[model samples]
Target: MDGQHYMERYIQEVVRRLPKGQRVEIALELQEMIQEMLSADGEEVTVESVLLKLGPPKELAKKYRDDRRYLVSPEYFDNYLWVLRIVLLCVGLSVIFSAVVNFFLDPKQAKEAAMELLYLPSGLLAAFGAVTLLFVILERLHVKFEPSQSSPWNPSQLPPLLQKKAVISRSDTVVGLVFIVLFCMLLTFAPQVFSLYLFSDSKELTMIPVFDMEHWNVILPLILASMMIGLVDEVVKLVTGRYCGAVLAVNAVTNLCQVMLSFVVLKMIPFWNPEFFSWLRKKCDIPDLLPYITEEAFSNLFLGLIVFGTALELGTTAYKSLRYGKN
Candidate 1:
């Protein structure tokens, strides 16, 4: 390729890594700088030589970035990978241990125990994502995990102090996504496992399902859809890495959908276990407690809490995004 093409490719590499708003200006500036350097020699200097002096495109891009954030920069990349490997190994081993214990606990539950092993991949994936996200946030926050042992501690020795910015807490969002995944998995495969266990005086065990499995099956799709929306919202927040009207808007829409799905689950469908109340009456000595506690009443209380939580999240996001969105 010609020198001009090489220069164009080099500029494109650096500018493409930048935000869209800065790309055009930065690209033009880089072209001018390269041209000046090429002319300053007063001889035909190869574009390769000029590019070499400028350094790699990735490093040049980093210099151009005002924020200087990286997912896992070279300095801490080794530590990040170390932690990631440990996390994944721990997650895998824990899943295996749980599965083994479950199998031994009830030898007849072999199929059920096998199902537990299926979670290993998801658990490892979540662990990997969480660790990577934590590192990314730490990078953006300019947090140092490995301070130099050779040098004495001094304020001057510190890395460039990062300015406080309105960034979406990527770690928290990842955690939320993990929980959503777990919740959806539970509802999808083993929701019947969520039960109230009672042991009689004779050591007899009784299990009462938490929700009417029949009705739960009916609303499962809606619940899953709402959760999927929640996942999308978190992913958007993760990508944006800053609170703004767009994030707030997404939060508002997802929360609304969740609230509606919750309403349908709680009010329209007979979600609670039908025999749960009767079992309580039969099994409990506290008669007065049973009188005040009805399925409808419990549903209403849960719905109210969901609404309250939604309101609080929306309010907080609005305050932050509106206040510091431009920043």
Candidate 2:
């Protein structure tokens, strides 16, 4: 290519990689620099020769950005991976659940379920792209997320050191972690597992999922966040091997959030499938055995259980916090 044409290609490559705000100015600067280099060479110069002297367009773009071109810097790379893993795990679980439900919903559609599994790669790619984009934004914004940079620690807040026998059990932590992961997967993917089922003479099982899929977008995220918090709490407990004020505080906060989220979801969405109730009432031979199946009754019961669980957690956390405070 001619000198001007070659320079245009090289500048386009560099400018395209750069942020939009800096593209024009950097392109002009690069052009000027190339011109200076060519003039200083004191000989006929091709664009190829000039670009060759400048190195790869990618590296040249980095230079314009002062070498801040990493999609995720080393400092945030671990966090990026951590977030990516969580996102992928959630997505994978949801996909798996959907596949299983589809298969069970109609055995003849097993092929469709298999086909649905094919979407996993694209789903994962989309999730990865989103997470990487977020990390890239954070990196460009120079957002620091050091846990140690938080409020100063107080020694007085430490819990009483427990005896070796009384320390947190590694097995318990491992089991809890596994349960949390599985719970998140099931909740995200196969929530229908919690639904009521009725078998008919046709040998087909009619299933009614506990929560409406329509509310999934709102409910799942809150539940996932709560599960993540629980996962972190378990990790912390395992690492520390003892309950401390910090642990108690985190547990309490997680419990509180979960309770609030549960209330919000229960209030906003119908928990029991009305169709399931109607089917059961019609198909079942025993009328007196069946309890009332109104939406309000089921919702109130579910909400009560959630509130009770949250209260129990808060009570335990408070007790532990007080014990730690005494120490």
After superposition on all C-alphas, the RMSD of every candidate to the true structure, in Å, is: 13.1, 17.6
In candidate 2, what are the lDDT values of residues 14-93, reduced to their tens digit?
66555556778988998999999998987876556667778766556666554344677544454456556766786777
The local distance difference test score of each candidate is: 0.71, 0.66
| Per-model TM-score on C-alpha atoms | 0.59, 0.54
- Candidate with top lDDT is 1
Provide the global lDDT of candidate 2 against the true structure: 0.66
Which residue pairs overlap in candidate 2's backbone?
A: none
Top-scoring candidate (TM-score): 1
Stretches of candidate 1 exceeding 4 Å from the true structure: 1-106, 115-165, 283-288
